[model samples]
Target: MSRMIFVNLPVENLDRSKRFYEAIGARNEPKFTNEAAAMMVLSDTISLMLLTKPFYATFTSKRIADAHSSSQVLLCLSCESPAEVDQLVEAASANGGKADPGPKQDIGGMMYGRSFEDPDGHHWEPMWMDPQMAEAGAHPVESATAVSN
Candidate 1:
């Protein structure tokens, strides 16, 4: 069986966060949803567990970081093309997310990406890469290492 990833996020408002994810194409999995939490399926393998702040806190002893003021992580999704990346970012912006919260990226036509922040300030990046370049293993990291060596 293939492994699946469930990203657990703390949400200030469950309903609003659920709606925002739905607007961006995630579907709710009712089997795991309640007033305090929601299971938003982003793809066959990727799911998001949106937990209310108090509910989230119960999982750990450390104080929750205010995502709006401090970033704990940056999540990224792969896209089919640069246009698809742009489309997702636009949809996020129209649905209460802040578009381009981080700088846009274009790596010599090999990669293109943009970022957005959800209503609760979770950062998401949608990115695309040239298939041929990827298959050839010509990503930026390898190129930079080669140049430095």
Candidate 2:
């Protein structure tokens, strides 16, 4: 079996966050989701464990990062193309989220990534990449990437 990674996020409202993800075409896995948290399936092997704030608080002694006033971290996800990047950003806006108001980056034939923030101010990045940029004999990053060609 392939090694799967689950990124867990602290959300204020499990149901609300679930709806936001659903608005952007993500599906919830009932087998791993409930009122306390929702398993957002980003792909076949990648999932997000969206845990409620109190539930998430158990994971750390330090306070959870504030998602409204300031952000100390940014979560990045890959997109299929530059267009998909734009579309996802737009969708986020329509679903009560906002843009980061920055320029798109071109990494000279290697990669391109854009960032967005959720309703709670958690950052999400959409990146496009080229397979030729793979390191030596590595397979690839589990996160999907958008390619020009």
Candidate 3:
């Protein structure tokens, strides 16, 4: 079996976080979700667990970082196309999410990306890449001109 990843985040409002994840295309895994936590399935092998701050505290003794004030980690996902990346960013922003002020990334013609901050201030980046260029180990700028149909 392939390895699976479960990214856990502490949320101030479990319901709001679940809605945000669903708005961004994640499906709710009710079997693993409850009032204190929610399981948002991103892909076949990727899932995100949104836990209430108090419940999440049980995992570690360290203090929970205020995501709105400080960035703890950036969650990024690969999209099928540039349009899909934009779509996700748009949806997220329309649904209680904020656009990241960071510069947009367009690595030549090989990669395109944008990011958004969820209501709880968690960062999520959506990106699209040219598979061929990546497989060929092509330089960002050089490959833009080299890759041809």
On lDDT, the leading prediction is 1
lDDT of 1 by residue, 1-86 (tens): 98999999999999999999999999999999999999999999999999999999999999998989999999999999999999
Model 3: CA > 4 A from native = 138-149
lDDT of 2 by residue, 45-114 (tens): 7888999989898889988887777777677777777678778888887887777544566556466766
Ranking by lDDT: 1, 3, 2
Clashing pairs in 1: none
Candidate 2: segments with Cα more than 4 A from true spot: 101-103, 108-110, 134-149
**Which candidate would rank higher by lDDT, 1 or 3?**
1
Q: Which residue pairs overlap in candidate 2's backbone?
A: 80-146
Write down the lDDT of every candidate, Cα atoms only.
0.91, 0.76, 0.87
Instruction: Show where candidate 1 strays beyond 4 Å.
Output: 138-149
How many residue-pair clashes does candidate 3 contain? Answer: 0
lDDT of 2: 0.76
For each candidate, what TM-score against the reference? 0.92, 0.79, 0.90
